[model samples]
Structure formats: structure tokens, C-alpha cells
Target: MARKKRIKIYSSNGKKALLLSPEEITIVKNDPSYEKNYEIEFNKGKQAFEVRNYYAIGFWKDLLFVLIGAFLSTIAIDYFISITGNAGLFPGGLGAIARFLSIIGANNITISASTLYFIVYFIMNIPLVIFGFIKIGWKFSTLTLIYSIISIFFDLILQNIPYINPNEFSLLIDYNLISSLPGAWGAIIWIFAFAIFGGMINGFSYSITYKGNASTGGSDWVTYYYSKKLNKDIGSLNIKINIFILFIVICLNTIILKTQHIDQTIKLSAIYNEYNSWNELINSDLGKALDPILSAEDKVSIDLFNSWKNLQTGNWNNEDWFNISKYISSSSEYDSYYTSTLVWKMKFKWIIGPSLFASLTLIITQGLTVNRLYPKNKILNLFISTNKINEVQQYLFSVGYTNNIFIWRTVASKKNAWNDQEQDLIMISMPLLYFNKIEDYLIKIDEDMIINIIGSKAVKGKNFSYTFDNELREKALTEEFMNNGKLMKKIESNTIIKTHKKMKKNGVSIQNEV
Candidate 1:
């Protein structure tokens, strides 16, 4: 009998080799020549390894795009909302599409609206993924899924965590949402910013994935598919398509708000967090008592408009009616009722400012299209700054962040700690900052206290854990609060912002407001 055929394969790290029977090697081969096929497979493995290395290099580049995209999208959407208000919607026909979909069991179906929505969305999204997969591979699809899931998860987490509010977080410092608005040019500026930033991220990610012979397998797949099929350049067209998607998303947003009649309610929720529960009965006498007396105000506005129109005609009025009209107009202006409405309006405006700004930022950047932009504000910037080795410790202390710091000092530590261990979610105030840093450190310290005398990373050995956030700071500020520092001021006067940055330190950034 012939000896059982055997083959050997080498790894790039020469210390070990994989033993495969000739049959086994053949199982993976497209051709029958064992040596020739083996060589081809070996070369492919080496290529994959090279691709992964390139991915490592491009990770930072992709990250930069995420930041840029998030910032621009936030600004763009904010401006869009400001200009259009909640009345923004798709022009005539698309409204009918959404309305038709909703009317035809999309929204009205017995299945929960959420489940129906996901089903519809998934069905719509499948084509993009499938098209993406053909050009790139399963790996590209996987990466896109990973990023998409992670992004969605983060959005969910942020939404649930009251402390991680994106709006107040966006305007933690002295920044004004109104200032970002560009009047008639706002949408144009916002769109460009979002697209450029998002495009950069998408390009960087594509480069890395492409180098690995993988794809992001979303819109990027569409980019690749068209590029290959039409024998056209992929880069520019991809960006344009993504930008178009972003615009579509913005238009869709307007349509959803208008059609669903949810815009005003959403605005109220964003501004006040007042209607925290749907169970709050409006029919209650207390609720009725709390209801704003705006109906009377509406009547007055209609009367005033009519009176103004009448006055415009230069018709003489009786003397008694003129005096009564004058007093009524004065009461509308200076009365307590008018003052109450004005105060409420002002407060509502303040609350919505940050949200509208952030939304505009997202929209303008065309984030849905490019995926380059990453929301920028105080908290994120703080996280980035604090990720440095020296800063990490102080950051922990300042934010009052606590977790097992010494658990992963080495490969040994990681194995031991990870064995039958709880999930290691080091809940720093902001993830965009802390995830990248502290890869290696020494020593273990108690999680309870900041300024832990013992906890130090043996790799980059240091003495103490960083300062923690103060109780007051924790109470008053949200997670996005960390990003509120004046970026310019921090660069220039560093000291001033740091004081407010860490609640442990005694400083007040908002002097006048407080």
C-alpha cells in the first residue's frame, strides 16, 4: 500500500509548522500539483499577513476620519434643523413613499414597530451588503458589520446613559450653537464639511481593507462593485455616492419628523427631558393646571395680524375702539401671561441649542455617506488627551473611573485574569479616549480609591492611579462634559481648562452662569 501522503507548511514565525497530509493540502487547493499549489497557498498567507499589518497602520488614519466625519455631520445636521426646524421633510413624492410604507403595516403592523422597522431596514440593507461582498469578500462584510454594530451599540448606550448626552457634551464650554449656523449658506458648508471628513475616513478604511483584499462591504462595496464593473475609478465615485446617501438620510429625517408628527414631541423631549414617562396623564388636573395658556395667546396673534392688516389699509377707527385696541396690544406685550410664554420659549431654545448643533454637525459632514466624521466636543477631546501614560493615571483619578487596572500587565496576567473572569469593561468617562491607551502598565491597586499608592503597570511602571472625578462634578456634568474645554484655550492656557476638566480640582468654567 502507498504510504499515507503527508505535506508540511511553514509559518512566517519559523518556530512552528503545520503538518498536513497531501490530501489535506489538496482539499484547500484549486490545482492538483502539491508543490505548486503549496507555494501558491504560502504566498497567499504571506499576502494576508502583509495586509493585516497595513490594516494596523491604517487604523489611526481611519480613526482620524471617524473624528472628522462625526464633527462635520454634527454641525451639518444642526444647521439643517435650525434652518428648517421640525418642518423639514422630503419634497412632495418621498413623503408619500414613507407614508405608504407606514400605512401598509410598516408602522401599523401587529409586530412591534421596532421589529417591523428592523425587518424593513435589514431587507433594504441586504442588497448593499451582498453587492459589497462580491467585490471584497466575507472579511469585508465582517468588518462592516463590526463597525456598524459597534456604532449602533454606542448610539444605544449613549442614548440610555443620561450622563453621556451628546448635546450638552458638544457645548460644554462657551461655544454657542447659533454661531455655527451660516444663514442661507449653512447647509452647503455643513454638507461639505461632513462629506470631506466622512469621505476621508471611508477612503482610509477602504485602503486598509483593500490592502488586506477585504472590503467594508457596505457603501464601500457599492463603490468597489461599480469601479470593477464599469472599469471606472473607485475613489471619487465612492465618495459621491456616500455623500448622496447622506443627503438622502437628511431628507428622510425631515420627512420622518413631519409625517410622523413626532418632531415637536422630539424637540420637547430633547429640550426638557420633561416628559420622561408616557404614563404621565395629561388629563390630570395638575397636568391641566401646568398646561401653558397659549390658546389665548394664539387668538391674540390672529387678532393682531388682522388688526395690522386693517391698519395697513389706512381706514379710520372709532376713538373708543382705538383706545381699547391700544390697551389690549400693551397687555399682549407686557402682561404676565406674555412674560411666562417668553420665558418658556427661551428655556426651550436653550435646551435644544446643543442638540440642534450636534445634529447639524452630523448632517453637514454627510456622516451617513462617508463615515469619516467623529463627533468632536469636550468629553472626546478630554478622553484623547487623557489616554497618554502620565495623563491616564490622572484621568482615572479625575473622572473617578475605577476598574482592575493591574489585571492585564502581561500575557500571563491577561490569561490568568481573563480565566473565568467578569467582563472587563473599564468604564472610563469616555471610550473614544481611554480604549487606545494604557495598553501596557504595571501594578494592581484598589478600585475604590484614586491616588492609589500601589497600582502601577510593571511594563511602564508608575506609582499611583490617577485622580477621580469629584462628586459635585459627577452630579452636575455629563459624560460628554469632558469635551467642554476650549480647545484653543487648552492649547494656549492649558491650566485654566484643566481645573474645570477635573472636578477634583477647584475651578469653575462657567462663572457667569453659576
Candidate 2:
């Protein structure tokens, strides 16, 4: 048994070799990462490494953060998406796409929209999760999987707490103008309210998921992957993706509206399917007269009736649409034939009209909030003019600061200061949090120190960096305590260095490497 420790040498490319024992492999096969990364090939006789190494470093803490992230995401789906969706605002996201798809797929499947949303969302993530695991790392994809699974569970429970909808909304303070459409059929959309509140919740959900070292799955996997691969800001990439989704929604919206219009104008609409006597109604002068109830409201009769009726309905002119509108509007006046229809089409039907503005507002708000909330690769270039340079440097690149070795450079300006000749400008580039910690210390020492900080879009470290020996240390540490001591695990920070963002000849990076 003691001699069998080095038994299994599964796959070795020599340069990046991982030696895992058969017993260890059996244990790690149960790990989430094992199932995610190696399940396909593993079942086919291929072997996997100690995926447990990727975890067991403050596992509980990570789990708590991930659960909180999941809870936030669930709230966004159950409350924000649900309410905004009910209001019929095409708030673009994975959820919106899922909802629309569910509507189409619902007739064939015996399931609710919310449950179908979870399925569609899960299906959408499968490919991306694989990509994330292969390209990004195990921790990210594992956390993402955990987050999504937990979110789905939480959503199923929360979705049952029935929403209360009064179906009344006003665009502004005025009740008479720009209220509901021709009839109260289309609820007057509270565009600003929906966009702001829902956008905020949605944005926070995304941010919290990010903070937990995971994503909300779906497009998030691609977003994080491309953000790292291309070294673009996450918020900027999110805007582009969300805009594309919105564009698709707009196109789909137009197609649906056109189809509905055609059904109403040419192919007998469901409301008039029972009516067999079109000629009898035409001969009765029904097209000339208006419904008494519709006439009772002066706003509908004088203000919106004619103009709303004149809306572009494919090849039909103002006169044609007016005649058709009159024919349709007057049908409700006759109760003997049937309790007929006075149709109210979609409110703010044009996709590029008020809905576009609302969608844009929501996405823009979401993007800005993400950028502000959980900032990554955020570098701070500091030029501290102080006489106590030694004290400042001690506070900055000192050994006692963290467990990992500090690697930083300060370009000492030899020239004397204009006001204070004793002062020197020490140009250093570090992260935001590091700069924050060194703030009050510098202030306390040099009461008149002028510190100028320039921020970067996305940053990566230069030659001076701390790379944790993730593999070797992972094995030795886990073997040592058997999950007893808290290991100083590698910091898997996303430091994407691309284009001009790579540490320039002039740019210094006081960052870490994992």
C-alpha cells in the first residue's frame, strides 16, 4: 500500500504534468470541477487531476458569497423581470430572451414561463460553461455553475409568491393625456420607474455574482471570457452584447406586430372569427357610426381615435385604415350579434419610439452600475509629492504588507520641487485598494503631500509580479492538514493584458499573478 503511492501516471506531457493517484482520482471525481471539466473524457477511460485542489481554500466563505449572489439573481428574475415583463417592456437580457422563447415553446411543452425560463437559461449556459472552464479556469466556471443552480432553485421557490398587479400606470402627472391606449387594454407604461428600479436590481445582481468570483451564467460566461481575452472593460462589452439582444428583440417585436396586424386586417382575427355576415353589417351603415361608450369618452373620440387609427398598417392608407377602424370600432355597439371587440393595440407600438428609450435607459444604467460596483484590473497611477518618501515606500512595497512578496517600482524624480525643494515626486503604479490603504498613511506623514492618481481602463503586471505556485502548493498544503489549516490559496485575479493595456514601458504594475 505504501509503495503504491506513485502507481498511476495517467497522462503526462512532461512540461505541465499532474500526478494523481487512483484513490485520489476516485475521491476528486465527486468534486464539482471534476464533473464539469473531465466528465466526458473521464467516463471514456481518460483520467483527471486533483480537482479538489481548485477548492478547499475557504470553501465555506466562497459558498456563502456564491449563495448570496444566487439569492440576488433569483430576486432579479422573480421580481424585476417578472414585473417589467408583465408591463410588456422588452427589457433586454438573457431573461427576456428566455421569456420570449418560452412563449413560443410553451404550447408544445407543459410548463410555466418561469420554469421554462430556468431551462432555457440553463441550456444557454452549457456551451459557455465549457468554454469558461477550458479558457478561464475551474474556479470561475465551478462558481458560475453553483450560482446558476442555486439561483434556479431559489427562483422556483420565490416565483410562487404571487405578484400583485393593479394594471394602472400613468406616463406623467396628467391622467387625461398619454394614459392607456385607445381602450384601457394597453396599460400606460411607467417607463422611467420600470427602467430605473428594475435596472438597478438587475445591475446589482450581476455585480454581486461577479464579486462572488462567478457569473449569472448565459451571456455572462462569454462576457467574462471575451473581456479577459480581448482585455476590454466588462461594462463596455456588456453594453455591446445587450444592444445586440435589444436589436434582435426590436426586430422580433416588429415581426410580431406585422403578423398581428395582418391577422386583424386580412385573415379574420380571433375576436371576429364567429362573425359570418360581413355584407349584412356593411349594408347596415355600421362603418359610419361610433360606439356610444367609445363616444362617451371625448379623449378617444376627438383626440386619439383618428390619429391612432391612421398608424401604418401595411399598404393601408389613412382613409382605408379609418374605414376599417370604424368598422371594427362599431362592432362593439351591436350586442345582438355578439359582444364584439373595440381593439387596443400594443402601447407605444413602435420599437424605436418610447420602448427603445426605456430599454436603452435600463441597459445603460446596468452597464454603468457594473463598472462602478465590482471593478477589476483597475490600476491606480500615483505621483506622490512628499518629503517623507522613505516612510511612504515602506508603507507601499514593504514585506510585512502581505504573505506574497511585493514587486513594485518607483521612479524617483531627481528634480527639486518648485515650492518645497525638499519634496520628491515618486511615481508608482498600484491597484485601487492598495492605493486606498496607503492614502491616510501618506496624509498623516506629509500633511501637504500632493498625490495625483491616474486610472487605467484595464491593466496587467510587468516583470515585477507575485505568482503563487498554485499546483505544487495546492497538493502539499491539502495533504498537510487534510482540510485543517486555512491555506494561502492563489489569488485568481483577472489581469488581462492586451493592446496598450499591457504594462507599457512607462506603465508600472504593482499587481499579482495567479
Candidate 3:
């Protein structure tokens, strides 16, 4: 056999090299002279590929975007907590991690729970940033760190806003609406509004951060890392992670309740042991009836009988009665307080808060992740007749729908020979946001035009605005604009009023037009 030929391949670190036999190498290296040249070219190509695929939208710009995202996310979290009165209702990925840390920190620290909670939240994210640095790119990790820090700073600032105390900031609208509404109607409205708006805001913030190719650190880093490693979609990964966190939260709350119950039981037992029996128990009608039946020869029964007799005969000291009354009153007060506290805590913390948070988070992450993976703008396919195609196409292009409009030649069949005309078939794929406008424009051109609108999941092409942009993304999904007909009516009314005033000033009779 010929001398076994060997080729060198660089590892990802570019420091270590691997030797492969010619037979083992997938590509054939035919020219001996160009073997070294081939390796050099391959290395250069690898470097170029790496550089091209990396995501970075300038250092400062990315930082700014991440900061803004963090700020908005913080506001959303605060709003959620205010409305629900349950910090556990925070829907962001970092929320579960933060709440876990807060609970642990609150147990150990003497400081304000809220203050310690944020501090721990900030500290816990450091490891996540490090992990991102190693697994993801350094730029992404740096941006995440910046976002976390900025978020922590903002959280602190929000807590101390001169006239506005975040802790005291309640959702007055929600409260008022809930209070005013009868039965479950108020609660239903409050919950629907809270979950929907909160999810939207949180999703919007996450999308904004993602657009900068970074995360606010926490599950975001984990989701991105696994998404890349496993060759999976980030949105799917996020849903799985959040579901796991929600489960953990439920388990934790259960453990907490059990532990609290055990502790309360132990305290009650200690109180029972300390007081033994109160005068009320000894002086009861049953105690009096039972004392006479016991034999005096029995020391145990005699001691109990004497104790009961002493208590009923007013032979007990003032100090003993004082201690007995104090203990009984304190125990009653404790039981009453604990019952109320437990009810509120369980209602808000264990049930309503987490359920709302999880539902909102799931909705947001699922929707947003799908949008991110499919960045193309949603389109509506419009098929129109040729007679009005020119007018419609011109109007669409004029209004910035020039990206994708497919035209075709076809015969337009008329029902009667009297109205026969050559009709041009035009198919236009317009962005969903402009669908209403396009429909109105088409109707204006030809009121009886044969128009069909088909909704498309996405439209892929250059020069088209992707749903990644926050404002456009929100407007498209929320349908924030008024209906075209209503808008046109308003405009027409205003124009008529202005025209009528102008005509009156000019001394012209335009009353009929007005």
C-alpha cells in the first residue's frame, strides 16, 4: 500500500490538532503540494464562517436595548405583584429564581425581605452569566450581565421613587373594578385583564431583549443555551423550563405549609404542657360531679379532687388566676391570628398568584418564542380582478406594500356576454397590519370587485418588516388602530365641518353639501 497519508484538523479551541488518515477524511486531498495550502484555506474559511454567524448589534446599542428591556420587564413584574399581592406572580423567567432566593434570604436575614429579595436575585444571576459566557458568546453574556445589573438598579430605584412607594402602589383600577362588580364578574374581569396585559408586556420586553441577541439572564440564558446545543427551538425549550419551575414552586409551597403546620403544632404542644390545666377546666360542672365519686384513699385521685376543690372554693391565689387568664387569652388571640394569616397566605401565595403567573408566563413564552423563530411578517393574500388591479397595486405600493405582489395573466369570465371584458388576475401578499387599509382601498376603487382575502402564517422576503420590531409587533397583534370605516367617517366629518365653515366665510351657499 502507498504510505498512509495524514491530514490535520484543528479543534474548536484551535490549539489542539487531530490527525486523520487520507481514507478517514471525507474530502480527498489529491495534490501533495497543495496539502498545506488546503489546511490554511480551510482554517481561514472556518474563521470567516464563525465571524459571519455570530450575532452582535454593536456594543452600546445592544446594552441600551437590554437595559430598556430590563426596565420594562421590571415594571411588568411590579405591576403584577401589586395587582396580585403575590410576588410569586412575577411571570419573567428570572422570577422563579428570584422568588426562591427571596424566600431563603428572608428566612436567614434580619433586613427588609424586599431589599434582601432583590439583592439575592442580583447575586444569583452571576453564575448564569458565567455559564452564558462559556457556552454562548461573550457578547451575549456581557449584555445579560448588564441587563441584570440595570434591572436590579431600577428595582431599587422603583422601591424608593420620591412620592411613589412600590410596596404601597396597588392596582387601584383592579381594586375598584373588582369591588364594584357583583359576584365573580369583578374577579373575572380583573383576572382576565391582569393575565392578558401582564403577559403581553412581559412578552414584549423579552422580545425586545432577544432582538439584541441577548437575555436578561436566568431561564433566558438556559433556554438559549439548550436551544443552540440541542438544535431545538427556544420557545419550546422555554415552555418546558417554565413548566418545571412552576412545578417546583408548587412543591416548595406545599413543603412550606407542612413545615409551618408542624412548627405551629409544636408551639401549641409546648403551650399545653406549660399551663397543664386551667381553672376553667378544673372548676367546670363535670369536674365538680367527678370529684365526689373519687376515693380519698387513692392519692392520685385525692390530689386531683383537692386541686378541683381548691379551685372551685376560691382558695386559689390572685397570681395563679392572673397567669391562667393571661395564658388562655393569649392562646385564643394566637389561634385567631394564625387562622386569618394562613387563609390569606394560602389564598394569594399558594393558589391565585402562582396559577396566574404560570398561565401568563406560558402564554407569553409560547407566543413570543414562536414569533422569534418565525421572524417573517404575517401576510394576507389578496386576489383581485384585473380591471381594478392597476389601481389597487398602485395604491398598495404607494402605502409601502411594494415588497411582494405577484401578478398573473388570466381570463375573467362574465356571467353575461353583455359585460364581457378582459380581466387581469392579480395576487398581492400584503402585510397583515395593512390588510384593513388595503381592503378599504380596493372597495373604494371598485365597489363590486371580486376580492378574496386569504390569511398567511408568514411572508418571507427582503425589505419586509419582521415582527421582531417591538412597536410593529405589538400593533400587529393588538390591533390597536381603529377600524378603517370608523376612521374614514371621522375624517369625513372633520373635512365637511372645515369645508362648511370655509364656504360660509366665502359667502357661498353650500348648506346642502354640509
Clash count of each predicted structure: 57, 0, 1
Between the candidate structures 1 and 2, which one is better when assessed by lDDT?
2
Off by over 4 Å in 2: 1-54, 85-87, 91-94, 107-110, 162-189, 234-238, 257-349, 381-514
Output the number of the TM-score-best candidate.
2
Instruction: Name the lDDT value of residue 29 in candidate 3.
Output: 29
Candidate 3 residue runs with Cα over 4 Å from true position? 1-57, 86-94, 107-117, 171-192, 257-514
Candidate 2 vs candidate 3, lDDT winner: 3
Best by lDDT: 3
- Which candidate, 1 or 3, would have the higher lDDT against the true structure? 3
Report RMSD for candidate 1.
26.1
Model 2, span 14-49: residue lDDT tens = 222224455643444443443333333322221123
TM-score of 3: 0.44
TM-score for all predictions? 0.32, 0.52, 0.44
State the C-alpha lDDT per candidate: 0.35, 0.51, 0.53
Candidate 3: tens digits of C-alpha lDDT, residues 38-82: 445444543343344334325666667787788877776656543
